[model samples]
Target chain A: MSTRFSPILICGAATLFSACESSTTTGGGVSDAQSSDAQSSDAQASDTQASDSGDGSSDGDDGGLQDASAEDVVDGDDVYAAEDALPSDDVPVVAEDVQARTDIEFPSDVDEDSVTDTESPDITETDVPGVDAGGPDVDFADVDPGDVDPGDVDPGDVVPGDFDPGDDVQTTKGPQLGEPCDLSIQTWCGDEAVPTLSCEYIEAEWVWTEYNENGLPCFCHPASSPGPAICAVPGFVGIDQSGRDRQAPSLRALRRAARLV
Target chain B: MADALTIDFDRSGIIDPVFAHFAIPVPTLDVPPLSGVVRDAAVRIWVDRARSEYVGVMIVRKLHGLLVDLNAPMDLQELALRMLLDEQRHANLCSAVVGALGGDSGVTFDVPELQQPRSAATLESQLIEMLVGTYACGEVVAHTLLRHVVKALPKSGFRLVLQSIAKDEVLHARFGPTLLASIRAGEQASWIDCPGDAVISALYSAQCRWMLGRDVVDARDVRLFEDDEQARAMCSVGVSEPRAFKAAYMAAVERVRRHARSR
Candidate 1:
């Protein structure tokens, strides 16, 4: 199943070049391609505070959390490692599992293209958990649906990966983490060249495009296609989906393979 | 050879396909030699971490089941399934780390019975709450701690293993927000109010206890091993002390808060 080079890969390639051209300063100081401030500051501060902080400290405040430079241990740069030398699209997929998937024969009546999540039939079952263990903390009854403010956990509160390029976009008033999106091909977030795919509903009807500011991609459930889906890009995170080709990009978002240069 | 899960399973004769997949090659895993107290402590710390990752298999399996059975959403089920694999991969890496640290990689791994919180609630409510705890709050805890640990260690095989785990964790940590965003405006609001923001506070507390200890009344203030000396020592060799964990936690908490308030 050799697909054409996905634009997401192209985008990653472009970003990779840009990231390299501008990755000269391994110091704590911000670089040109530093996408998100929160993540950069967060990474810098964590590295600093962890080294400086002993157990004597009571709280993890920004009090002693100074932005320490990386020049001390700047012997090697992981930026390239993060880009090329790290894992390929050959992520994790059991060979037997892929073989089993290849053997599946959909019903004769099933129209693969026309089918959406709601109409799609439930496929064979994989390993699942039986709810034998018992527990409870908050009763849903206490959380009055009608009275509760629309604001719960703000999607903005989502702490993006330490080096997520998306955070740079997300910080600029992007959709909250759980905001609704659609599968229609015509729409691009603010940027025409999106990073990867995102979700409309939580179930399986998904496509992959760039993770633009418009659609951040929602979580998944009842996925239309289910199996071990892993993609292996030449220079980027493996970007393939079991069902929709675009799904690889969405999963890539889940991987958020940050550039740890 | 010292992996706890594989220790009991015979590798001879017809083997399972899943186990075969564990043979995939990872890059930059050259384990640096360790000695003295640092070696002793690194072994101890990594062994405990491996066991924790071992338990993670159960946790991910349970979470995957919850997502599928509840029919929460399409992509989430897929995400959980991928997460299932990621958890196993992390366990594998951690076991490898334990071996490199001079300890037997085969620690006492336990498969504690899975506890389904909000057992009395509707499947919808349970799914929402669990997502908050498991991905949002819980992964946040894991990511923060791991990131802190990764920062403390130099470039070594141990660091590479932890860094790989961190890559997956960072994504999982962001799942909470994405899930919550979907829930807020979805159709289920008619029957269920929201996924419950308090889910973060409640689930985070529960996670702190699970990771640190049972007596951790407040995650914000709890010290690792209940001793500062042990905590500081652990921080040096890539095993964060309790205070270090708290620092990352606070940072994670603030990230979520800032994003929330950004609007």
Candidate 2:
């Protein structure tokens, strides 16, 4: 398509340059014969240059002359002779290329006359050529919304690998040793009401019971028992066999017990 | 009377004794005769020393029992036994000094009855309570008082005796905490928990009474001197003033409190 339009485009460019030169020389002090000679020499030079570069054919020579007349008509009436020269099959291609070039080169030439000529329905029909070249129009609005199932967007529908709801659940352990225990709060207390026994509170009255086999204070209970009992000394409380007490241990006695002295 | 009184140091029952090497030459009966106040004070100091020594004996016995009960590996038993001998020596030394000062009757206090273990809970608690009360509180207070006395007294046989006893008391004071540390580091760590506030409170109260002699109502009657000058003199020779003793007692209590908190 570009091959057939190259010669015509070249001829038109040459003719426009020649017309511009002739218009510039028309009011000069040169005589009419000299002016005509200069104009004929310039036109012949433009035609030769157009033929050499446009198509390498004799048709470019006549095309250049016709182009000059077309330029005169266009200057007076604002029209292009290249559109008439274009073949029917190549008309849309050539018009598109020309329109594109005009838009790029002379974007600021949007006079009312140019807009009316370039923006006509006939020029818009040329856009169909692009579609005919295999660029299909996609109408997203025609797609059925029902084809996409709404369940696909549901979070529960997606299954993540290695995910087990039970694995996230944690089992709580009961209160550890030495932790304070509350009788009311059974959860942390577990099976026992009190976490551990303390010497602050005496659970039972200490009595002077018979001695056990270990010869310890076996006051009321055995020596290993864990409860309050009267120690051998008056006004003293302690476990029978444990040797633990609320009072300070007598160092003098301990020395004797160890039999150091 | 002989020119110089000869003490029967050999009969004191300290085998291969440390103080045996010293040739203690007793002074004349009097450059000035022993006054009533000085005599009373001297007798009292000796009596208290004897009683404290006896208590020392009992403390070791309790420690031995505790070690056995807990099956603790540290054999404080032997050290405790040795401390018993040292206390006995201290008691005799105080008594001898009392005799030289004109209190010939020697330590007038009766043999104290055996005190039962007061910690009626676990064996570990009992051991801890005993250690805090005896070593941290009792012996520490004794060491402070004796140290002051040793500093106040002039360089004499009496000061030497108090110094010797004070040195032993300091070791006795350290025994408790050392044993506790060992227990904590060993398998018995579970048993050695920080004592609750109530136990510490009871222990502190007991320590204050023991240190200040508040537990014994007649302790004031044993004052070594009547006047300030005489009291100062007594303080110089291992008899602490009542106010100073109380202050030292309170300090010991605070120490024990801090020790408990750290645990």
Candidate 3:
């Protein structure tokens, strides 16, 4: 998907530049033919140079590739033609990315948008993914609701083999002791963009999402949403009537899980 | 495997979760590898202590519920709640002690018997059984056992917590007498004639018998009445004291039996 979008971004930048040049030339002494001929030739030369320089190195002066790497430049994007490409017409990319990158943990008692936790150890400050279980300082990272196993006693429950990275994210085996992988996303390099996904232990509760349909409550991703309902972990197998997912285990069940009985 | 009752409480949201309050501090023992002897003893001690404290909490809570059940005025109810809360605090303290010594200290219970009306006639007998058989008999006896632990365990935070819990139990025992007097006054207590004497003596005897059965208590340790060296030690056979607790208890039992027989 990312590879297909690259060429379209470059073309859009070029179009914007041409429009500005044409508008400026209209107010100057240069004839429309001369002005358009010069700009068109310049654009062609830049495009040709970009294609020849192996992943747009010659067109490196174009700030479009400023954040992307050489292999991911315009040459990589050439796989998608301009006709097949669509421009990023003020599509609120930054906002969506911020929203999509919802895997980060937030403060327990703060607003969803306020990313900093005054009393907590900041997620960005720690390189180690999960809570430093043995650290002097306890950091309760927002657990991934799917990874919780309070009574993970059975050896057969071990997540099979080492984790493999792929597109289909689903669980094939239950969790077990010391199984060092996330089951929801079939990945191994551990989503560098969102390190929380690959932690050894994630303790999260079930959360309901606004988009739930069929009147069935759904466990929501903490990364994309923030509400009291977002972190309420549901029990073994029950959902609330309002269609909002419930994570509050029955008091009796909680006691059993805690080994109080 | 975790107990089912604990699971039920975990789900009910009635009591706060164990992790919310208890703190497990560093352990002081020099436990060796695969040394099941030391580890097993430690684990046993922890389990026993947790079990003991749990009964205490259950008793106090049940007693509190009973006070409310009897429709005893507000003053009596308030007194019972205070005692119940004290018992909970003791449970919490014991839980912290167990955790500090590297034991999992959550309290779990099975789903309670189905909720029947509070006014059921059988409730009184059940209350009597729980109080005489479980609390006074079970928990008070546990205190006798833990008295040995306080001495055997090396001086540390765990011992300190045990001491605190024991002190609370001493006060808790007084509740029996107060409630017993009230039951006698109301004539609602189960046993006919000298019911208070019968219940108190039975509980005291049952407690002694149960404590002695735990295998930890040695007969040579009975020191509540004697001046012998073994008697001075914490694990002494204080339960066998001839002239002190047992004498008073036996006399009370004889009185209740005579009254019942004459009637």
Candidate 4:
């Protein structure tokens, strides 16, 4: 959040058009073009921040403009790279970054219709694990659910924690990332402290066995499952069954906790 | 079917019960259904899960609605249609899935009641026009939560479906800013001002902390923002730049605030 860099919605715009190629290659081209784009993006970043800065130049001082390092200038997406900040050994190696760092110049003039607007003509191909398998069955064994620590076990699983109908509850299953969840197939795991009862169970016992047949791992909370999986976590239902049922309040509380609200 | 409880509404109805029924847990795995005190715990857990999904659906629907329909330069209109189709399918799929889980289908849109009828020619009068504060705040929360869901879910048959959905969203998040920038460009020179940014910032701040709590295990562990391929594909989308995404959100909020204040 603190990084100071130009803000442009890169999506194939500058990349496909080759608009800035001339600016970066010519003498002082890189700085001029970058500085100009920086100014444009900065102005758009926020009216408030731009106003407060008095002069937008205050932001460029943060080291975004330092000579390019091993990191390739990822054109469209404005990646946040600390100026002169040495690349870490662990981050995944990018093909673009292989080149040695240099003080490359960018184009000074803005050509709206330039070919650089859209980078490469075709979308780049990248590899995804299990995407190619294309098999009907999922490779569950390939997934590493990671080490589950017992210390952080939630008590709500064992005993519904202090239930407050009006209290805002956070749901673990909200559309947090970007996709919709098929609630029917979503697998539920009770809190580690109390692992019992789930939507899957209902399917297995009273409903359909297809849910259990899928054999998905249970990750009640987020930040656990990295692989493609639909995790269902059991929630607490308030005892009040009348008008303004406790379920509504309890559900609201979970959504609040998850920040889905 | 004998014990089924049905409730019908003449006007609009709240979706809490629909969500709660889905939240109720029945248990999975090879373990036998727990009885006595354990049974109590299990039931509680089940309800909570149902509740979470219920909340998640609402957020997803609203966020999707905002992102897919913004006016833009490129194939946004086409993209918007595609997104709407996808969302409508999603809504149908969600309804079917929830119904299968014993949850009732209680969702209904009353936009006609909320606003005066606007013809296709008067699209500008639409009440649901993407509001900057709502879009920024909802999506801030949505992006973070979806990321967490993606990380939390593992590879399984069900997960495959989720993965497909998540993959689609990665693209959706990419445009959040491009659309905002377009709006900002138009508003900067216009007579009508944009929205105040502070409200959007406040919403984003809340969403950020909420995301941290949901995704982060300890202070040391930073959840990978994007998986290897997701990161690459997202990076390629030029619009997927998080920095620009942030800027777009900020600018949008400012425009909304300004516009609202002027109104």
- The DockQ values of the predictions, listed in order, are 0.02, 0.00, 0.01, 0.02
Ranking by lDDT: 1, 2, 3, 4
Number of clashes recorded per candidate: 42, 35, 47, 78
True contacts kept of each: 0.00, 0.00, 0.01, 0.01
Question: Model 2 segments beyond 4 Å from truth?
Answer: A1-261, B1-32, B104-112, B115-122, B185-229, B232-237
Q: Write the per-residue lDDT of candidate 4 for residues A1-261, one digit (tens) a residue.
A: 100000111111222114322211211222222122111111111111111121111111110111222221222221222222221221112234312211111222222122111000000111000011111332222222122222343222322323333422212211121122222223333222111122222322422123232233322121111111222110111111111122122222333444553
Best by lDDT: 1
Candidate 1 scores an iRMS of 22.5
In candidate 4, residue A48 scores what lDDT? Answer: 10
- lDDT score for residue A190 of model 3: 13
List ranges where model 1 is wrong by over 4 Å.
A1-76, A80-261, B1-33, B109-118, B187-246, B250-263
**Model 2 C-alpha lDDT per residue in residues B1-263, reported as the tens digit of each score:** 01111122224445453333321222222213446776665565555555446444444555655665565654354455445545544555555556666555322211112232223356666666666566545554454445434433444345445544544553454455444444444535644654544454444333332222222212343343457777655654445454444443344434443334333
Question: For each candidate, what TM-score against the reference?
Answer: 0.43, 0.41, 0.33, 0.28
Query: How do these models rank on TM-score, best leading?
Result: 1, 2, 3, 4
Give lDDT tens digits, candidate 3, residues A1-261: 111112122222222224323312211221221111111101111111112232111212211111122121111222211111111221112232222121112123223222111000000111111111121211112222223322232222233444334323322122222344322221111111111122222354222112211111111111111110111111000111111111222443443444553
The lDDT for every candidate, in the order shown, is: 0.35, 0.33, 0.28, 0.24
Give per-residue CA lDDT, model 4, range B1-263, as digits (tens).
Answer: 01111111121334676433322111111223223333332233223223333333333333333233323223443343333333322333333333433445443211111111111212221112232222322332233233223223332222222223332332233333334434434442332233333322322322222122121121111112234543333222111223332233233223222222222
Could you tell me the lDDT of residue A210 within candidate 2? 22
